[model samples]
Target: MLRESHKDRIQEEIGNDEIVTGKGLNQEISLVRAEDTRWNSHLKTITSLISLFPEVKKVLEYVEDDGDNGASRLQASGLLSYFKTFEFVFYMHLMLTILGLTNSLSQALQRKDQDILEAVDLIRTTKAQLQMLRENGFDQVLEKCYSFCDKHEIVKLDMTEALNPCNSFSQFNKSSLLKLSKMYPRDFDDKERMILEHELDIYYHFVYNDVRFANLNGIADLARSMVATRKHLSYPLVYRLLKLTLVLPVATATVERCFSAMKLVKTNLRNRIGDDFLNAALICDIEKEAHAKVKTEDVIDRFQKMKTRRGQI
Candidate 1:
């Protein structure tokens, strides 16, 4: 129901005295529709909804009371009732707060710079923020919800009981550490695995207490700190584990990119290509940076040297 005329009516109802001719509503705010593929779209939609709430209610009330179409009137009535409920308002504010917290991290990950270290640091920061919110943010959010309900004349539910937030952060326990070590059997034999267990116990305590490593943001930073302090020699197995963790994201992204490149390489027109040629094409396509560095003349000379030719160029 939020057409140009409807927006004009909303503006007039809200006492916005701006005058403009020929469909020029200078202060009109429109609702945003969310998309499935883009998560930030949901955040934008929520923000717009919150901003245009009074305008939306005015439009819906007009439609429900005096609209020309019966179906439109029924829809507007149902929506108006739903929008005034405590549950809807409460969840809307909750989602707004949560999405706002992670929006920066989401934008960082989508950047084209491929700075894995920064991305990892953002991941850690996001996790810590979420944990803190879970532990201590409920009362603050509830107070906001209460103020909103009071302003809007919505009924407030009694929130007398409080829930104990469960701790979800992963702890480096013995079993978990052993499971991680077993993933790379070649890197750690039986003797080294036992040593790694001991090293982990010491490493966790040391890092937590050490001033230099206290503020390290990412695994890469921790690795560098270990080397700079010559602690890598002190805990060789733990240092090795840090190195593995550092490359895990890069390795995962490379594998994902290779699979994505396959879709472009093995099209319907090229479906008949052999496995050997397909593999070579995918490798070149995925590693374009490395492929671009080689000289064309060198590739041509290498191809020519593979077999005797009747004519040489």
Candidate 2:
């Protein structure tokens, strides 16, 4: 309602003009109403809010002070109280900071150029950075939060007070975590050296002796090499592992794409098509390059060979 009422004014002020910042986001972008179905959308929503925080605060204040109805005014006041708080401001910055790190990692994982080793290294680096942040950067984050709160005119909380645990009743066993961390030895001591030797011997005995995998670069390379050489039968365990790394779709993106392609291929107009026909049509539509490679004459010959026909074109 607030947006609708002031749409004309907002348009007049912004006028399709974009305000570029660090993220290259435009100030003309309106505040997004988040939905549960699209959880990642909340990240974008938060970003937009942060970018337009000043303008948004002004609008919220206007609604609270000048709303036409009591209900609108009350709602606006509640929104202002909720938004302009130390907790909200802190959490907003916290999420933004964390998500910025994870977004890079996510993009790295999504890249075709990233192999398992690189991805694993990226994960370890990100994990270490997060641990470092938790251990040493809390004060810096706190200072930033304080700065944001001051800018927003929200009262700062007492920093000396003990921080509240997420679950007061839950017991966190720090000793157990320490013990678990020790399971993966950081230094190659006598015991660690023996463990590493045994593991390496077992691994090399199976995979290193295999000539076909001699030049395998990464998991992706292993999958392709094994399949190309038809050596999957020679090394069952290694083949299985490599196959999983290659064929297993991590993000449901491929499945979603297939479904979307199915919708286009098997629409209401072709709803009554047989299951086999639908599958074939979907395959052709989805695999456009492969379908393009196939000649029309070859398809005609294959159709004719399937069964006897009254006439052939």
Best-performing candidate as measured by lDDT: 1
Model 1 quality (TM-score): 0.45
Tens digits of per-residue lDDT for model 2, 1-313: 4354345545554665532234543224667886433334556788878757767777879988999999999998998887876657766876666656555665787679888998889888887767666556656666887887787688765332211112331222333222222322443345644453444345445444666656544455655665777766654443443332233112223444577687787778878989899889888877888899999999899999998899985
Off by over 4 Å in 1: 1-28, 161-313
In order of appearance, the predictions have TM-scores of 0.45, 0.40
In candidate 1, what are the lDDT values of residues 1-313, reduced to their tens digit? 5556546665685575555545554466678898643457879999888867777888899999998999999999999998997667767887787778778886787789859988899889887777677766766677787888897788765332110011211233544455556656788899999888887778767766677765655455667888999999998987776665443211123544775688888888988999999999998998899999999999989989999999884
lDDT of 2 at 131: 68
Model 1's alpha-carbon lDDT is: 0.71
